[model samples]
Target: MQLHELEEFRLHAYENAKLYKKKTKRWHDKHIVSLTFEPGQLVLLFNLRLKLFPRKLQSKWSGLFEVVRMTQHGAMELKNKDKSSTFLVNGQRVKHYLRNDVDRELEALTLNDE
Candidate 1:
């Protein structure tokens, strides 16, 4: 009888562990935001591997690169503003770069017709 109880307890424990993992995963995924980029859009690239003794106050993102192309396999081709260089990077490493002038331009266009 005791052996049967132990086996049942172990099964219950395993089920509880699976439930905990599922709840944790759901909570984590809820907080994650999906990012997308388009061609001609400017973006900042994240540098995952930073140099030793890097500047403490500096941002990990570098450059306002323009999206040259996107691939079906989740790769993005980016080019510098001067068109001097290009590189293919993973889409996960890039984020949209917002410029201050964009807001000004929008306000100007909205105020023009009135």
Candidate 2:
């Protein structure tokens, strides 16, 4: 085509590319897996101190705890398997299993424009 027409096409493409990039970044940030847990859901707790509990509390499978509270920073308050003790754990430390109700609700929320 004409030189001026080609230049205009390039400019339009560049603007669309910039807009898409901005939208993609926002979507990535929004879905960074910041989630909460309910009162009875089971989770695996991560131990921060490796040396303290070597035999019994080996930083994994310490207890099949139930969630007590959903805290800020995506953390949760957990009750021990025996219902004797409670602790606050970070989202990074806990892995939530598949629950049909909660999982469906999460899936229904529309993804951000990207």
The clash numbers for all candidates, in the given order, read 0, 0
Over 1-62, each residue of candidate 2 has an lDDT whose tens digit, in order, gives 69999999999999999999999999999888755567788877765665754676334545
Q: What overall lDDT, based on C-alpha atoms, would model 2 receive against the true structure?
A: 0.75
Model 1: runs farther than 4 Å from truth?
A: 102-114
Give residue 86's lDDT in candidate 2 (0 to 100): 84
Show the lowest summed lDDT stretch of 10 residues, model 2: 98-107
Q: Would you estimate the TM-scores of all the predictions?
A: 0.78, 0.45
Candidate 1's TM-score reads 0.78
Candidate 1: clashing pairs of residues: none
lDDT of candidates 1 onward, in order: 0.90, 0.75
